[model samples]
Target: MYLNQHEIKSLLNKSFDNFVDFVNTLPDIRFTASPYGKWSAGQQLDHLTKSIRPISSALGFPKVTLRYFGISQRPSRSFDQLVTDYQRVLNGGFKTTRAYMPGVIYPSQRPALLQNFLLQKNKLTVKLLGWSEKDLDKYRLPHPLLGKITVREMLYYIAHHNEHHLAKLKDQELQGYTWQNQLQQLIF
Candidate 1:
């Protein structure tokens, strides 16, 4: 589906709101528990937070380092590291949370994490509202697994990724399976 600025912004806002609502309903125990064996609630939050860092950085302002290094040649970095770096940048005033991903760090101080996640999501919605069609077309960064992709593509993938996780989270909630229990079932 093609999206103009207004449409994109609307989608972003709605998605952000939906995410906040979902998180708000989650009990603290669930937030800390891993739905699956591989990732804790905290780790998933870290992963989502990491995923958006490059996209926001690429789109919000051009980085001379990126230009100089080129997309393909940029240093290999772990997603977790990038997320942490983005957080640091936010704290330092180099970037705002508004441009970051829309999820809270799992197992964090619940109130603050939720507050920050919602705040950042709102900021990102505003940023999306300001984007031009041309901006969407611009290549943001290279994915470690998928190679180069545009801002629009990244946005689509981000939504899909969130949906995938949300589905899993829902399953965990409905089944009432803890991380260890899920692992035990898989082993059997």
Candidate 2:
């Protein structure tokens, strides 16, 4: 479904807040625990924060600057189309680069990570507010995974992204139960 800027803003605010609360609720050990050698909860948050920096910078840029960067003049895709496009990229095996991965931050640094997350998230929200919905629909912003997209699409991702990560974290939370559950399934 499509979300206007206001709807997107609300969802983004709620999702990020909820995600942070979820992280805070985790046991100390869960911060660093890699359920299956995949990203730990902390690493996932770190990656998301890093991923947002470029978008924040882009949001700060003037339209002229975007022009210099050769912002796409392609037709603005609908919000759902933008999300579907990103999903396709993931299904196509688009992995985040190593530089974007978490390092030297985990259980011991949870506070720092959470603080940074708030800082970056705040910047993104403010920058987004600077644009009109039409402006958001008109200008193209480069996304690390989604390539060039209208600002509206960017916000769409911003709105939905944390929920995606939150689901992953929940799966990780349940990771230790898998083996026991499997045994029960077999016994049944």
> Which candidate leads in TM-score?
2
Residue ranges of candidate 2 with Cα displaced over 4 Å = 71-75, 178-188
Q: How far off is model 1, as Cα RMSD? A: 10.5
TM-scores for the candidates:
0.63, 0.86
- lDDT per residue as tens, model 1, 1-188: 55556765666566556665776687666676654554544445555555655555555665444453343323323333433443454456552234333344445566665565555555566666556666555435565444465555556555555555566566767776656766654654
Residue 151 displacement (Å), model 2: 1.2
Report clashes for each candidate as comma-separated counts: 0, 0
Q: How close is candidate 2 to the true structure, as a TM-score?
A: 0.86
Worst 10 residues of 1 by lDDT: 71-80
- lDDT values for all models: 0.54, 0.77
Q: Write the per-residue lDDT of candidate 2 for residues 1-188, one digit (tens) a residue.
A: 76777787787788889889999998766776666667778888898888777877888987778765454566567767876888898899888787787774557889988998888788888887888877776788777787677877887787677778898898877765788535643553
Clashing pairs in 1: none
